[model samples]
Structure formats: C-alpha cells, structure tokens
Target: MKKNYYYIAILAFVFVFSSCKKMLEEEAENFVSPSQFYKNEAQCVAALNGCHNPLTSIFNQGLILANEGVTDLAFLNNQNNETRFELSPANPGMGKGLWTSAYQGIMYCNAAIQGIKGAPIAENRKPALIAEAVVLRALYYYVLTSTFGDVPFYTDDVANLATLEKVNALGRMSASDTRKFLIAELKAYVDALPKLRTSEVPNNRISSSMANVLIAKLAMWEKDYGTALAALNEVKTIYGALAQYPLEDTYFRNKNKPESIFEVQYTWSVSGLKKTTQVACYFTPPRTANTSTYNGINIPELGDKANPFTSVSPSAYFMSLYHVWDPRRNIILAYTYNGQNFTRPQSGNGTGKPWMGAKFWCPGMDNLADGNNQKVFRYADVLLLMAECANELDDVALAMSSINEVKRRASQASSASINLELTSYPGKVEFFREVREERARELMGEYGRKWDLVRWGIWYESIMNTVANEFVDIKQNVRPYHEYYPIPDNEILRSDGKLHNNAYK
Candidate 1:
C-alpha cells in the first residue's frame, strides 16, 4: 500500500528534527539537522505551516462526511456505506482517514511547539506561536474524541521510528478526561492569543475569540450551559457590540469576510508547500457537455466536466421544514435543472433526491480544488449557540434576542416568512424547539447537524422518524451503536490491543 502524502511529509520532518548527529553525518542524503534548522525564525514558521496542512483534507472531505452524511439534513450520495449507518471497525473511509489525519496534524503541532520553544525568535512572539499550536492540538483532540469517543491522546512528538511504535501502545483516554483537557488547554491559551483578528494573524489564525468559541462548543457538548454562556459572552466582548459582526448574505465567498470567526485558509495557486480545498468539486453540480445543463436542466456551467460524484443531496424532511418564502430556502434548496427552478424531484426515492445549498458552490474552478475557505466558525453560529445556552439557562429574553439576530439577517435577503416573534413561542420548550429548527435551517450542509442532534439527545429518535421512514432499510440496519463511529480496525491492530472500540458499539 502507498503511504498517505501527509504522513510522508510529516514523518520526514520528524526524522529531520529528531535524528542524531551521527545518522545525519553518515547519511549521504539531504537532511536538515534540528540544531541547524532551529537557528532561525523562518524555519520555525515553515514548521508551523506544515501543522495546518492536514486540516485542509479534514475539512474538505472527512469532517464533512462524518458530521453531515449521517444526519437527517444530508447523506453521502456516492454509495458511501457509512451514510446508511453501516460503519464498522474496518470501515476505512469513515474511520481510518479521519483518525490518521487528526493524529498526524497533532504530531506536526507538537513538533512545532517544541521547535519554536528552542528557536531564537523574539521573546514577545513566542507566546502567540505556542498558543496557536496548543489551540490547534486541542481542536484535533476535540474532533477525535467527538467522533470516536475515546482515542489515544499524546502531546510529545515521536522522536524516532521506534518511539512511534511505543506511542501507539498508549491506551485511550476517557471521553470526560479528553473534554476536561481540551477545556483547560483552551482556557490557558485564550489570554496569550490576540483578543481580536488582526492584520498579522487574521481569522484564519487562532485568536482569543476563536479560542472562546471552541470553549463554548465544548461546554455546550457537556450541557454546561453556564460555562458555555460565559465563553460566548467573552467572544461578544472581544468582537464588540454584536452589531459589528452582522450576518453577511455573501458570507460564503472567499473574501475572508467579517462574519467569519475561524476559517481554514486555502489558495488557488498550487505549490509544494501550499494546500487547497476540494469542496467545489465534491459539492458543485455536474454539467453536461452538449448543453450547459445539469440533470437534464440547462443550468449555467459551474464545474469543468460532469464527474461520477455529484453534490450531496438534502433530505426531503429537511427541505419540507423550510417555508416556501424563507430566504434561506432559496439560498439552500433551489437548483436549476432544464431551465426550471427545481428544489426537490417530483417523484423518486427520497434518499437519492438532489438539491443545492448555494453556500458551498463555487463557479469556475479547476478539478477538485477551489480557493474558497472552509468556515469552521462564523458569527451566526456563535449567536445560535448563545441562544441554545441561554435557553438552557432559562433566560428566555436573551435566548430570543440571540436567535432573532440570525432570523433578522435571513429576513432581509428575501421576503421569505422566516421571521420569529417573542409572542409566537410562548413557552420555553416551544422556543427551544424553534431554536433547534433555526440552527438546522441556517447551518445545514455546513457540518453541524449531527452534533446538534446528538447534543439535543434526539439523534436516534429524530433519525428514526425522518430519513429512516423514507428508507425502511435504515431503521432495520441502524442500532444505538451507530451514534458514534467505531474505531478503525487498523488503528486497533496498531495499538496492540491497548485501544478498544466504544463500549456501546
């Protein structure tokens, strides 16, 4: 089997950094010894850049499929077995890719942290760099724990090939322990990071606001509403006057707009060192050659050619939840086919149905790569999260204000009846339900659906009612174990029995 490109690059760096002087001197090949490499700031910065490369593949594919494909909002359309909740310990696509990418990213971060500490950089510059690496490591751990439950957690870099095998022997950390570690680590970094996005390190780099957002997400996952609210309030204070970060309708364009709090940066220009996103190819509709059409519709050409893989389709239940005039409906549901506005097919199997969410579509892009930055956190997401925290705290007034901010933005784009009034939802339960629905409407296909459902304690029941109904096979095939994906069989084998699958699985 061929080695993953990311693994090859990161492993090569590890050998360079940790290899002994005798090995470097005896070897006739090119190798930059750690002592020589850490003598300058440029090398340290280059090492930091390597840490971010794995995230490009994570956001472009693995994270999106794992989070969205199993949810009611969408399912993988490329005959991905994981979409049907048929994931197994040996499922390479769903389990192996994510596990490997996240851990490899963590290794790069650890190497960066160690290298930067010894580098002869400015005294004041060290804290921010170290903090950024720490926060990034926290993010990788958070993703791993969320998806696979318990995973082997480590902070030190694997010093040699032998050390790599020893590191694999470590046992998995408990989920609660992983969450506590992430929260504590994030809190420690918040003070060291820049309070706001700056010209030097914009939204793409980890800032205090981004750190707080991660804190809020972790807190919310644990249902610790008070902690989540505090972190969100800190984010609000940093951004200043929620009005400063109003929702932008064209937020999806790759301009790095003000609405973004944290986004993974990608570039169109290819280089040996640079990384790009593949969303435009995976999410955009295929076009035919004879006519500028898609699925028999004369739509304007978006991608260069019609590929075997197409956009992930929205579920019928998800499409039905929106009102006809809702502005988001137009943004998310409408797709042009044969010169007609087609949102849902008139007749067909519900699972295979096609619809477009314009947020991820990018016109005029090379094959499988686009410059559009993948949004990890946005101002709208923060507000909706605030609403959820406030609702849990029984602060109905705050909750209403928080959620209405998002609705207010949606109402402006189109005359869609998407407005929500305080009077319409009299009770807290009713209001919270609408808040959930609002999040689904605003964040569909953006990779928040499964986590939202899981946190709401409605993942199983919601699926049993919605998508499972249309595809009866789903209900029969799914089990409680399906909630979290199983650890890949290869990971288990590599661990030498030190790690085990989630107990529920």
Candidate 2:
C-alpha cells in the first residue's frame, strides 16, 4: 500500500523520548534530547509525525465500544462492561485504552509544539508547523473530554521528572471549560494551518478544513450554534461545491480523497512496513450458518476465503432508518454483497441481519489487520452539522437546504427531498428531530452518535427507548452518569487522589 511518506518519519522518533515515563527510566545520554533534536525544519515535521502515531492506537475496538458499540447505532454482543454499563474506575474496559492513547497523543503534541517554538526556524515558517501540533492537541482533548469528561488538562511539555510529577498531580478541569479553551486555541492557529484537502496533504494531515469542522464540533457541544454554523460555513466556502468530492471516495477502494477532512492513515504489506487497522473485523458479519467456503461472501481483493470475526453489528433501529428511495441505504448497510448473501441469526431488536456495509469493509484483510483509514471528519458530516445548527438557530430555510443537499448527494441527483422543509413539519422541534435522523443516516457508524445524544440531553432516554435486543442490558444497567465514562482507576492511583472518577450511581 502506498502511504504518505511522512509516516516513515515516525521511525526517527525511535532515538527520541517515547514518553514521559520512558524519559524518567532511560538516560538521555544515549537518546536525542528535544533541545538537540528540534533545531531543523525536518525534525519539527518528524515530531508532528510522532504526534500522529497514537491515532491508530486510539481508534481501535476500545474506541468503538465507548463511542458507537454502546449507542443506538451499533452493539457489542459480548458482555463487555462498556456495553452493559457495568464500568467502574478500576475496570474501565475500553476507557483505559482511550485515555492512554489520547494522553499519549497529547504528550506528543505538547512536545512537538514546545520544540517547534524554540526551533531556530524562520519566524514565518513556525506558525504553519506549530499549527498542526496545536490542532492535534485540541483533537486529543476533544476525544478526552468527549469520552471521560472533566479530565486533567495541560499544554505544558514535560521537560523533566519534576514537570512530569506536576502534570501527574494535576486535577480535573470541567469538560465545558476544556472545550472552550480548545476552541479558542484552535481558532488562533486555524488560519496559520494550510488550506488543503486530504488528497493534497500527505497522510491525511490536519488542514484548515479539519480545524473548521472541529471548531464546529466543539461549538455544538457547548450549544453555541452561531459559532458552529460560522465555522461550518467557512468549510463549505473553502471546499466549494460538495459534488466534486463524491461519497464513493468514502469507501476504502482509495483513501485520503478530497472528501476526507481528516483520517487515521494505515498501511499493510506482507513483505514490508505495515501499520494496519482492525475496523474490518469489527464490522464484517460472520459466515452464514450451514455453509462452507465462507458462504461466498468474501471480498475478492483480500483473498476472499478470510472470514470476518463479527465483533460488532448494526442496530436494527439504525438499519431501519434508511428509506427505500435513499441511495445511501446500499452503501451503508448490506443485505447482499458481490452477489453473495449476508445472513445472521435473529438478534438486536429482533431484526435478524444487516452487516456493516461497504463504507468500512476492508478488501485486503489479513487476520484482523486491515489497511483502511479510519475517517475522522468528512464533507458530508459538515453539511449535516450545518443543517443541525440551522434548525437550532430557527433558520428553517437554511436548515432545509443544508439537509436537502445531503439527501440530493445520496440520491445522486437534484430535487430529491425527505420532508426537510419547514412546512413539512409542525414546528422547529419536529424539524430538529428530522435533522437528528438525517445525521444518523449519514454518520451512524463513523463516530459521535453517543456524543450527539448526550449533548442533546437524550443519551439515557434514547438507549432506554431503543427496542434492540442487544440494548436490553444497557437499558437495565444504564444511569445518568453513564453519559461519561469513569476515570481509569490506575490514573487515579497515579494521580495520588488529585484525579477522581465519575459519580457513577
């Protein structure tokens, strides 16, 4: 797989400090200190690549369990505590991996930003390079606060053991305040960042488009609709005419296309360097019962004989959201693929079977190693968010246009409608409900379903009302505090009581 060459730069970090703890344990005599390393532009860029490494670690099944598997869009059939709402500070399940990766990413970003600031590079050149690290730090915080809520916040680099100890002893900050700080920080550097599409950038590097989308995302979390809409509008203006970036590019046939705003890049090779994702195994259905040769459901490119692990399945309610006229139905969910039937036993709201469709399926899968980029932000998501903001701001016409554009794209022609107009609904509340459903149709399995529910003040209610059989335990075990996961017990122990767990009642 041909990947952006910057990924290769991450190899350079092997001689540098990998983490704060590693610094404390290992001597700097044999390693390249930050002061010795960040003197040149190439080293600064390499530090940015180091910041990107943790993304792969962060987007695994653990992230899915916390973000999507427990939500209305998908389910984990296993007895994982995250799905069953049985999580504790000690057994945070997937939350442990998420917290670890996010902080790891944050640490790398802080180190890069600190290094770049003192790098003797040209004054004009610093902003763009530093901008990448800044946005990346904000992205990590977005994940941290979105999942854990009110986490220990820091932007300082750990220069030595003392600084590391101070960071370790820091207390939690309010999620809202953290988000506010992130928004302001991102806005400060967004313009300094390059204005390029994912295709134009290497390895889906953070661009101005991604910053704007994230700004909108953070603003929405704060219920600051005006700010969110403004940021999204900036993206629409920059990207221009969404048709140029087709939805088909969203498929893994080729990644980092123009439509992609940001993604976690992956590459797999049997004879060479390989960094892969397990997303395919997480979504693909198991072999059909009473059949041999994997039931002919194999994707030809990936040695069709490989069977999927079926670790996660789409909820019946999520599958049922598709309209008969909706062209996205086939793209997002599958009853059949490549002339082979997809079948599963009765489960999850008793709707039987519908596998996670083409958008996520990996063709060249080996074992659980699939080389597909996990999408973080895309153009369609921006449009849907715009529609949501318009509804909240009472600009019904804008709301209709924003959502209708998404429908038109899905239908592949103009004049397609799904009752998104003001007159089509009784009032703004009904219109807002339609917007929620539209967002689900566009971004169900990608991310942010649980965050959407929580920000809209409906996570607990939505899960309890969902009729999926898989959600039975969740409904019985869920509480209001389940909206945010508990802090990992090890983190609390490490913090010496400065950090605390959620009040999980």
Candidate 3:
C-alpha cells in the first residue's frame, strides 16, 4: 500500500492526505500557507481529504467506548469508568478523548469548507468537494451532540487566535437546535453529492448515501419519522436490494465492499506509511496482555500472536437474543475457536469470556495495528432504520417488509423460524419492540446502541432491565443523566465560564 502525503498549511487544520490515491496518509510534502493553497483541483481535493483525519483519530478507542462500550449489547471487562458508569464531568474518562478528537475534526472541516468554496477549481467539481466537507462537518457535530447533550457549535473557520478564542468561549447549543441545524445543513448539499456507495468512490469517501444516512440519524433524534424515511428511501435507491449483499462479505472479512456506505480506512505496514486502528483489540477475546494465549492455551482463531486489550466482549444478555437456527448467530458471536470451547466468567466475575465473533477478528494483529477498516455506516443499518421509521409512521406493512429483509438474511431460511417472520407481529407496539431487539441481534458490537435506546427515551430503563451479574455496577450507578455523558471538565474551563457541565444523579 504505497501512499503519498500532501501538507496543507492551515495552523489549526494541519493534517496529511494522499496526493495520488484516496487514503488519508499523513506526511510532509510542501508547506504552503492557507493563503496560497487550494489553488487547483488537486489542492482542493487534498483539503477535503484532511477533514477525514480526525475521524480516523477517534475511531481507535474514543468511538468504540462512547458508542458501544457502555451499552447493554457490549461489556468492557476492564471496569472502565465509562462502562462502569463511574465517569463524571471532572474525570470524564473516554469522553475527554472523544471531545478533543471530534472538535479537531470539526475544525478541519470548517477550514476545508471555507477553503474549497474560494478555490479556483472547476465549477462542476466544487459542489461535490464542498459537499464532502459539509457532510464531514455535520458528522463531527453529530458525534459531539450525541455524546454530550449540548456543545459549542460553529461552522465557519477561525480567522486568527482572537477568533479562535471567541469560538472557544461560546456557550453550549441545545441538542435539538443543533441537530435541526445540521439536518438543514445536510439538505443543502445532499443533491450536490453523487448518489453512489462509498466503495464506488475512489477512497471510500462520503457519498450522497452517507449524507442521507446522517440526515436520517439526526432526524431520528428529532422524532421526525417522515424526514428520516425520505432520506433512507434515497439510500435504498442508491444501494439497491439488500439481499445481494451478504453479512459475511460486508463486514470485517473485507474492506470497502458493496454494502459499505462509509468505513474508516486502515492499513498495517512494517515500513512506509501505516494507518491502523485498535478497534479489533477491544472486541477480541480476553487474553494475557500482548499475547494470544489465555490460560496458557493458544487460540489460533485469534491469530498466531497478537495484543488483545481484554476490553469489550459480548454480554450474556445480548448473546441470548439470537435463535439457534440463525446463521448470524455464529457470525456475530464466537462460542468456540479451533474446536476449543470458550468459557463464561466463573459464577459472577467477567473473565474467560467469549470473543465478539469472526466479524471483529484480526489475525496476527500484534501491537494493535489491526488493518481492518471499521464499518461506520452500512446497508443493513439503513434497512433497520427504515423499518423503525415506517413502524412509527403507522405503515406496518412497509415496516415489516423493510425489517424482514435483514431478518431473512440472518435466518438464512434455515427453518420456519418464528422470529424471522417480522410481519407476524402486526400491532405497531409489538412490531416496534421486535425492531428494537432485531437491531440488537443484528447491529450489536457496532455503534449507536445507547443512542438508539436514548432516542426512544428508554436508555436508563433499558439498561436497568439487564440481568447479567457482570454488569451489576452499570445498573447500580446508571442514572437518567447518564444517557448523555457530561461535557469534559477541561472544555468547561476553556470556555471561560460560558459552558456548563451536564447534571449528575
């Protein structure tokens, strides 16, 4: 994987992207100031690519922790403060890293959008490039608002130190207003974006499909089902039938496949440029630190030698949701590796737990430089979201049809699985409950579980329903305010008394 790095000279937005290909590789090529850059199409493209850097930075751990680590579907075995519900406004744990990373990406997007608009590029090329930056900006905001209830919001690039300080000192915006603003912002550029999948794009970059996915997601937060369904319809048209793309091919086994709407690109290399992630380390089975052996037994499925973080793994409650005949049962959970049985935690403790299935396994991923591209948005998630919207809008038939597509694929038509027939649950409330559980069974270990429950106004109560003894601390310490992590305390200090911390129990 050969990569070239171009240097863009914005003080706040100094990151590297490939000069030849689509990968966001970081290196120094030339040091051109903001005033002299974005003079051509290539320069404009480089600016847009830089916006992707912050997303890669956060993907390693911040994203996994904030989105999945604390949710009921996954468990962080190391007693992480966030996963244990022990974090606070002062000691925010993963929230601090997420806050810094998301804001940095937003700054890059803000600068790139302003730069691309003024660049002397071809007129026809400007919209797509600017739209990429626009969507990227919205994505960063989405991360911030979803994680923390409210945050300081800005779309324009900072001019100087004085302007930067002013922006930093701004107060928080309401999450509702912020999401509404981002939804309208995306609509302005959705048509300008090409209606294609990320795999069809050169670097698996943002497409019109991705923009619509984000719009639908933000709209779901607002409880606007009509807007969400309309956006998802556009995605359905672009991605085509869901049956053609299988779960095995679309996830960890490959990168940038047909169903990939957006993936954080990663590469592992002993020499040259290496962009990789630690995401796989979390979900992999618990092992001795820096070794693949557990209890002095080597698991070949976890690679010959690797560094496993012993972090997140499937919860007992989550594993209980899958039917025995479901093909996805094995794909999503690893019961045995290489003919050896995995064990549950002895009694109540969470040790010797099973790995998070083949989808997250990275063989020989020593030192946590796993080359697997993290799936951010995919076709399966879009289908489930469509079903949720349809059910909410009183179109039970459309809802059933949409969800059944994913269920049919998981079931593999192996038997007359009663659970596979989502249409059987004709009542709206009953059907919606099925949709929620189906989301857990299908999208588990992926992002947005806590958000899914929160948007439905059930985050606090849902986690409370867990009977798993390993998560006793989570149920004991969780509160209504825990639905949204508090804004990192340092951010409040940086805001010059303008930003306030979220309330605690």
Candidate 4:
C-alpha cells in the first residue's frame, strides 16, 4: 500500500476522509498556513471540501487494521469482550489509532469552521457559508462525542502556540447538552440553506437535504425520538419519493441510488492523484485494488477491471443475527461465493476469511474515477428513524410498517413490507430495545453502531463488560473519564487548564 504523503495538500480538513498514516510519511516541509489560502469565495468553498472529505475517511478506510465498519471498539470491543485494546491505553493496536484518528477529524472540522467564518467572504455569501461550516463542525463534534465520551469542544480557531491553551481548559461536555446543541444547529439550516451547493455536490460535497438527513440522523442517535421524527418528516416532505425507479433498484447493491440523502462523492483512477474517493481504494478486494477487470458484477462501471482493497471481516456472532431467507441478507453480506458457498479467507486467521458486508460495490473494470457516490444518509435511515419515534410513542403498527418498508424495499418488493411486528414483552422500553437491535443488523458496517449504542445508554455497560477480562490492557480499560475523550495533551499543556475548564477531567 502507498503512504499518505500527498495529504499535506489537505492536512487541515481532509482529516475525516482518509485513513491515518504516520507524520513521518507526510512531508513536514509541505505544511501550508491557513493565511496562505482560504482568502475568498472559491478558496473558502475549497476549504469546505477539505472539511467534508474526512467523512469518507472516518466511515470506511481511515484506520486500516481497525475497520470502522466492523467494530465499535470504543464500546463493543472494550466494553463486553476480553479485548486487550480496552485494557491498555497506550497499546499500539487499532482501537487507540481509531480513537486518535476520529479526534483528528474533530480538530479538522473545528479549524475549517473557524477559518471560514473569519475569512473575508462577502456579506451576501457569508450566512450560507457560515451555515455550511457550522453544519460540518457539528457533524465532526457529533462523530467525536459519539465515539469518545468527553471530546474537547471548540467553536474557534487555535492556530498558534499561545492560542492552543484554550483547548486544555475544556473537559468533556455533557453528551446530552452536546447533542441538543448540534441537533438544533443543523435543523436551523436544513430547510433554509440552498438545495444545491455552489461548489461540489455529486462529488465529495454536501447539500441542504444532505444536512437535513444528517440532522435527522443526529436526532435519532441522540434518542430524541420525537425530535428525530419531526426532523425526518421534514426531509420526507421535501425529498422522499423514489418514483423515478424502484427504491430497491436504486438502493441495496447499487451505490448512489436516487434516495441517497447525502453521500461522499468519488472520482478515482489508478493514475496520478485525483479528487477520487479514497474509500473504495481502501475497502475493495485485493484483486480490485490495482486492476480494472470487474465492473460487470457490481454497479458503477460494473464490468471495469479494478484493484482490490483489504478489510477486517464481520464478526461471527453478529453474522448469526441474520434471517437466512431474506434477500437482503445475501445482498448485504458476502459470506458465500455467489450467495451460497462459504467465503474463502483473504487472511488465514480463524475468523479471518474474506467476508464483505455489502454496502459499496466498486466496478471491477473501471478506473478509480467511476463517480460512485457513497450514500451517507439515505431515505431508508429516515424511515427507520421515523419508525423508532413511532415505537417510542407505542405506535407499534407504524414502527413495524416503517421497518417493514425498509426491508421490503431492500427485498425489491413493490408493495409495503410484510411480516412486521415486535413480539418483545410489554413496555415501550423493550420494544425500543428490539428496534435498536434490528437496526444493528440492518444498518451494520455503516459507522452508526457505536453511536446507536451510546444513545441507547448501553455504551458504558457494553465497554465495561467487553474489557472485563483485559485488566492489563489500558486501551481496553473503560475509565469513567473515558466517557469523554481526554483533552489532547498539546491543548491541555497550552491552556494552563483555564479556557474550556476540563469537561471530562
């Protein structure tokens, strides 16, 4: 695999889209000051692209060995199992790398929001631009707080040595307060912002509806079911129909289907660096990583030859949660070749046979520039959010219908979904639990699991149980302090512990 030296051009905001690599691999000499760029409209918007770029990184390919799609190590690996990463804080394993990488993205979003707001863009363009910056920043904070407990929050720029002190004074903010602030901030802009972004939209950028779906998502994750329902209802009113084509045809195995509320756009090629979505390059099969021979099987440039990418396989315990007869069961996972035989192992580890949880499909024969948009928040999630909200109010019928709707579409059925019901014992709490577990299975491998657990209040318990056997592994050890990430060491040392006032500390 190649190193990420080329990222110096995007070091500030691109933290969210690409994977983690050593600073040694990046040329320190190439670092550019913000003052040198982000001077005007075009430059500011370019800066926004850098902010959104990291979305792809954190979701699919940032920390290679620690697949974000495969485990919520922050909770699952460290909370329930006898995992070492949870026991050892300084362990050079994947969990710490993921922890560090996610925070780096938060830092990038913070910098972009601050830089764009302070830039000299015209007043006429400033509100929308500021809105975009805030939306992205809120997104960064959302992902950060969801993964690590008390991530230091920043709404300003901290560029120089003396300025970095502000960060040290902060500790973890209450997750509840953090969620409320972010959700409100995003809701305020979704309908008011422009439908289409002036810069990039179909390729590595976000739009108003994208913000809408995300707000809905943020609401759902925060367990504000009523608010989440209201938010997604707004989205459905504006952009929910899939009449142009069957929802399933556009969704399921095909990437960038019309129902996509928001996505990470990619234009990859085997040649010199392009504004390609690095995600596909990082997760496709090893055979597709360097070749251009297989586009016919998947959706984008279906038969084009392509290179293969490596990834951690899905957990065996989770895999058993599926219903064998479901069509999407096969479509969502590649346990057997051609949907029947066991997948051959890409690595020989006991559970390490190659198994792809189908979400993104790279065209085999096409170059990296196949233009496949990675759907970030699709209608399906909105539907689920709505259903969850319905369940919260004991509207079992609506909840069942909503889940069934998503399932039916995944199964390519034209009529509403069938066999929907929550058979759990009594109360809404039990039903809510069932809804969440179902989502875990239905929405696996999409970087939403950890947040789901946290929002449901099982994050602490899960991590504690997971790391019970790893008493020596500091990384696996779940400290009450860990509910919020530690303030970055640099920021703490600089702040003299005064500015933000140690949140988790």
Q: After superposition, how far is residue 91 of candidate 4 from its true place, in Å?
A: 2.8
Best by TM-score: 3
Candidate 2 lDDT, 1-505, residue by residue in tens: 1122223223333443443221111222333456677777866777777777777788766676567767877777777666777888877877888888888788788888988999989989999999998888888998888888799999978665556666767899988999899899889999987777756765456788888888999999999999999999988887776667676787754677888888777777778657776767767656544333333464455564345774666777777788755756666777666656655433455356676777777776667778887777888889889988988888878887888777767766322555322345447887788778888888766667888888899887787766245557776777888888888888887788898864863
Cα displacement (Å) at residue 333, model 1:
1.3
For model 1, the local distance difference test gives 0.68
* Count of residue pairs whose backbone atoms collide, per candidate: 4, 1, 0, 82
Point out the higher-scoring one by TM-score: 1 or 3. 3
What is the C-alpha lDDT profile of model 4 across 1-505, one tens digit per residue? 0123223323543332222221111211212466565577766666555555455555444332232342432212223221233323323233344444555555666666676677777767766766776777776676666655555565655555444445545665676677777878787766546674222343424567667666666776666677777766676666544333353433323645556655554444567434444445444444433333232132344444554444344445455555655554544555543433442542365344334534445554244433455544666667777778888867777777776666655445423344333443346676666666567556554556656665666755654543333333433444544433333444443445442324333
Cα-based TM-score, every candidate: 0.86, 0.88, 0.90, 0.68
Model 1 compared with the native: what TM-score?
0.86
Give Cα-based local distance difference scores for all models: 0.68, 0.74, 0.76, 0.52
- Give the CA lDDT, 0 to 100, for residue 245 in model 4: 34
TM-score of 2: 0.88
All candidates: CA RMSD in angstroms?
5.6, 6.4, 4.9, 8.1
Candidate 3 has what TM-score?
0.90
| Poorly placed runs, candidate 2 (over 4 Å) | 1-31, 288-298, 305-307, 345-351, 413-426, 467-471
Candidate 2 at 49: error in angstroms? 0.8
Candidate No. with top lDDT: 3
**Deviation of model 4 at 334, angstroms:** 1.9
